[model samples]
Target: MSARRIDRRGFLKTAATLAAPIIIPASALGLGRKIPSERITIGVIGLGGRGTQVLKDLLKLPDAQVIALCDVHPEHHREFENGKGPRLGSTPARELVDKAEQARSGQPGKPCFVTGDHRELIDRPDLDAVLVATPDHWHAAITLDALRSGKDVYCEKPVTHLFAEGQAVYREVAARKAVFQTGSQQRSDALFQQAAEIVRNGHLGKIRSIEVGLPPGYDKPMGSTEVKTPPAGLDYDRWCGPSPKLPYMNARHHRWWRGQRAYGGGVLMDWIGHHNDIAHWAIGEELGGPTRVESVGWTTPDVDIYDTPVDYEIACEYAGGITSRISTKVTEGTKWIGENGWLWVTRGKIKCSNAALLDKSFDRGEWVAGPTGSHVANFLNCVRSRAACIAPAEQAHRSITPGHLGYVSFSLKRPLRWDAKSESVIDDSDADQLLKKSESRAPWA
Candidate 1:
C-alpha cells in the first residue's frame, strides 16, 4: 500500500522561521489513521512487541512499506501469542503487515518475506530501510550491518548494548551519512519538545540541576531456575547471538531479557535513553557526555538469573556546569531546576514551576528548535528527504553514555572521570576496559 508522495514533510515554524511547535498535529500527514502511496521499502528485523508497535506506525506511513520480517522466534499461538507482547515473532508480524497492506490498498498486496536470520532480510535489494527492534545487545551489530548495506535504520532506543558499540554506531552513521533514528520517541512528542525548547531558549533562565528518575528492574526475576527445551518455534542459539550461551529459560527470552547484563543492561540502560535524552535535549547537549560520574546506594538482585541493580542512584557532573542525578528512587521523569523556575516532562504530560511558560510558546524566537511531530513519521520523512533525524546516532550514543558509565562506576563502586571530547575514562584502566564489550562479543564488538 502506498500514497503519492507530496511536499508536506516539514516542521511548524515560529515567527523567527525556526521550527516550533506544530500547530497542526502529525495526523495532517496521515501519521497512523490514514495511508498514502508508499515510497520507501522497509525490512523489519525483530517482530516482537516493540517491533509490532513500530510496524503499526509504519503501516500508517504513506511513504513506507514493510516488506520483510525476521525474528529468532516464530508464533506459537500460546499464552505469549504472536501480534501481542511476550512472543509475537516474525511469522505473526508478517500476517499483520499483509492485513494492513490489503486493508489500506483494498487489495491483497505482495506477501512479506519472513525469516529467522536478519542477514537474509538485509540481503534483499529492494529494501531502502530497516527497523531493528531486537534486544539491546543486537542493536549495534544489526544497525552496523544495515548501514553498511546502504539501508537507513530506525533502531529502538538504548541504541548500544555497551559503550564501545555506541562508538561504533556513531562512527558508522557519520561515515555513511545515512539517516538513522533511534527509537527515542520522546524526542518527537510536542510536549517534550516544548519543555526542552522552553529550557533551551532561556525561558527557565539558567539551570540549577536536573533530576531524572527511572523505574526499577523491568519485571519480576523470580521464575523457576529449571532450564528447559526452548519452544520449538524459537532458535535459541541465534537468540543468544553474541551474548553468552546459557540454557534456555523463559525469563531470559521474549521481553524479560533486560534483567541480565549478558543479554540486557537492566533498568539503567533500559530507560536511560528516554528521560536522559530529554535532559540532554533541554540543555542543547545532545552530543556531549558527562565530565564525571559516580553511583552509590546500589544493590543487585539476589537471584543468579539477574545481576542488574534493583536499587541505585547515579550522580553525574557535566562540563556545562549542570549536575544530573538519575536513580530508580526518584520521581520517574526529567526535571530541570532553574534559577527562575523549573520544568518537568514525562509521557503524556508537561509542567513547569512557572506555569506561564507552558502556554508561552517559547516563541520569543531565540531559535530553540528541536525534534517535532510523530517519532515514526519523523524517521520516514527523513528517510525520503535524506535529512538527519531528530534522534540521530551520535545523540543516541551520548544520551545513553551516562547510564553506561554509571553502570561501570556502580559495578566498581567508585567514581570515574570522563573526558567528554575523548569519550574515555581518565586515569582508570579498569573503568576504561569496561567501555568495550568482552572478547566474546567478537566481530560485532
Candidate 2:
C-alpha cells in the first residue's frame, strides 16, 4: 500500500466540523439499572504487561467487557489461556478471561477471541473501543486505524513514536469524533492534580522556572550483534510492524525496544509524557507546546549495543515565558519555582517552601481542571457519556512535543525554535524535514 498522506489543513478543518457536536447516542443514555448485554464491549490491541493490566481492570468494571485480544506474539495468548507465562503483577490475563466470562452470569456468551493481527480485532463491529498497549512507535498508527474503524481509543503514553505522526493522529481522532485517552496515569493521581491547581491558581506567586525529572534509561547490555533466527510462535515481522524489519535481536523485542531510537526514544521520550505533561499542565498549556528546546545527552561510549542516552538534560521554553528544565539527574518529580515560594510534588507527597502555600484550597469544581476518576475508568466513562477524556489527543500530542524537540536538538547539536502553531521546527529546513513521518516498512506504509 502506498503511504497515506493526510493534508494537515483539510484534515483538521474536517476534524473541527466533526468534533463540534458532543453527541450521546440514545442507547447509551440508560441511567438506572442496565443489563450486562448493554455494557460497553472493548478490544485490546497489544497483550503485553500493560495491556494485560488494562484488560484485567476492564473485566473488574461492571459495565465493560474485553471481548478480543491481539498481539504479534502468540505466546501472550497461550499463557493467558493455559494460565502460564510471566506474572502480570496484579491484573493477569487469565483473570481477565474468567472475569469477562463471569460478567455474562454463566449464560452462553461470546468467547474471548485472540489473534496476532490487530486489524482482525479492531475491525470487529462489536468493539466499542480499543486499548492500545503497543510500543511508542505503533501508538499513532494503531490509534488512527482504530479511530477510522469508529472505535474510541485508550492509547499508552508518549503518544506518537515520531513527532510528525501526532498531528495526523490528532486530526483523525477529531474527524472520527472518537473519544481518546492517552495513558498518562499521573494525570489521575490526586497529588499531581493538587499540584497543578496550586500552580495554575498562582499559589507559587510569579512563576519563574519548572523542574521536571525522569528516571534513567535501560541499563542492561544491548543484545548480541549476531542475527538469530526469530523465536517460534513470534511474528517478528509483524512485531516490528511499521518499524524497520531487521533480523531478530532479543533485546530489541518487548520492553527493551525503548532503548533503541528506531522503535523507541529512550528514557527522554518514555517519561516526558508524564513529567513534561505536568510541566505543561501546571502552566495551563495542555493543548499547546514549547517554543524552543535545547538538549545535551550522554550515550554509551564506544558501544553500538544500546544507543539511547544514559543521562540527558533539556531546557524547554514554552510560549508564555515558562522554562521547563528537564533532566534525568534531578530528583524524580516536578517542582515549580516562583518569586514568593516554590511547590514540589511527586507521587504520594507534596512539599513547599512555605507552609502557608498548602493552606490555600480550591472549591470542588476548582480542584483539578482535567478529567476525573482513574485514567482507565475515565476513558470508559467518556466512551459512554461522550465527554472529552482528560488527556485528549491534542494534550497528548502537545505533551510529547518537547521530548521530540529535545531529540532533534540533541542530534543537531544546537537549540531549535519550534512553531507550535505549525507544529514544526522554525527556519531550518533540515530540522523541519525531521518533523515528518519517515517511510515505514512495506505493506504498512
Instruction: Summarize candidate 2's per-residue lDDT along 376-436 as a digit string, tens digits.
Output: 8778767766668878888988888887887777778889998888777888888878767
Give the TM-score comparing model 2 with the true structure, all chains together: 0.86
Clashes of each: 7, 0
Best by TM-score: 1
Q: Against the hidden reference, what TM-scores do the models get?
A: 0.89, 0.86
Model 2 off-target regions past 4 Å? 1-24, 27-37, 76-95, 103-108, 219-226, 359-367
Off by over 4 Å in 1: 1-38, 76-87, 218-224, 360-364, 441-445
**Candidate of highest lDDT:** 1
- With candidate 2 superimposed using the best TM-score fit, by how many Å does residue 276's alpha carbon deviate from the native? 0.7
| Clashes by residue pair, model 2 | none
Candidate 2 RMSD to the real structure: 9.0
